[model samples]
Target: MVDTPAPGTVRPGGRTARVRETVLRTAGDLLAQGGFEALDLAEIARRAGVGKTTVYRRWGTPGTLAADLLDDMATQSVPRADTGSIEEDLRANAHLVVKTLTEPRQGRLFKALIAASLCDEQAAEALHRFYATRIEEWAGCVTDAVQRGELPDGTDAQRVIAAVSAPLYYTLLNTGDPLTEADADRAAKAALAAARAGTWSTAAPRGRPTPNCDN
Candidate 1:
């Protein structure tokens, strides 16, 4: 539970919000610098120049703090890019995933988060939600395609969106291979082909309109 001021006790307001932001930022910096093991809540309070009691009162544990930080990140995360065409939208999605993976701070941050979540259920759940939100955001592209008649009715937008990024993430995390634009292109093309082939249709998979990818 969050700390509450007693009667006649000063309650947190604007200044408190700013202090919380500062503490979270400080914690994020520490997390980015090192993984979960490197996180130090007391140190974060010290760096933020806030009382340790205040920090503890706001967030009870490293996991809670991390979860809250991830929540904030989700709120500020990149919105899905709409390019008005399925191909363009998929390409943009691929590029965005690549860009995020290759970014200096974000890449390592995610890596650490993923590593930390292995042993922490709350962190794991939070991470799962973050990806789910991202996937749903990207799914809009496929939904738009279906509405535009680029795809047939009843396409699995979620699976299609996941297909585009799943392999990229796999290669990045599981293998030593670097995530490149070429990889993104391959995934996009493959997903597009599969979608065209009705590989992800909701109805009987036997027959559907064949997509012409020569465009």
Candidate 2:
């Protein structure tokens, strides 16, 4: 007798993965074209050539599907830059963010995801997880800089990393300003300056140290 795989344990590159890829691609295409409201499971199954039941069973709802897509994106995101100098690493990170947000399809997809997150609790959680993953990946750069004495001791690595991308995101979301390579460089430089100036330090306050309570 042939053995059947467990319900949720399909091997990588197997039939399940292929189905998932097709459905996600179709979903992404629809999202880029018409945002979150355009996501319909029946239409997704039709476009992906998968069974409607399969799509529904796997993803359940539009919000859940969007959350799954974000999870996939986080998994597939590029690793952080590890250049010797923190400035170079941060510049690379800023440039990458600009490149992603400026790409036509990806930009639209991101906008749709952000919109979905605004209206859907599940999508919001997934969006938060996505950023957390990306931030943790890049935090290594700050830690390395601190170890090399380029940044002061007690620097908050995640804060420094967040600083690098904050302005770029603001440009993308808040202002209608075009994100240029120069802007990317300037963001990285500004974050590096602040980090070097101890803006993100986690050290004790300047006034005094805590008194030892144990007697």
Candidates in order, TM-scores: namely 0.85, 0.89
Clash pairs, candidate 1, are none
lDDT (C-alpha, whole model) for all candidates: 0.81, 0.90
Candidate 1 Cα RMSD (Å): 6.9
Candidate 1 accuracy as TM-score: 0.85
User: lDDT score of model 2?
Assistant: 0.90
Q: For residues 1-215, what per-residue lDDT tens digits would candidate 2 score against the true structure?
A: 99964322232778889898888889999999999999999999999999999988777789988988888899899999999999999999999999999999998899899999999988899999999999999999999998998998899999988998899888888897888999999999999999998899987645687879995
The candidate that wins on lDDT is 2
List ranges where model 2 is wrong by over 4 Å.
1-13, 204-215
For candidate 2, the 10 contiguous residues with the lowest summed lDDT are 4-13
Residues 1-215, model 1: lDDT tens digits: 99964311233669876886787688778888998987777898899999988888777778777776776677678888888889878888888888888887877787878887887776787788888888888899999998998886788999998999988889879995888898889888889889877788876544556678997
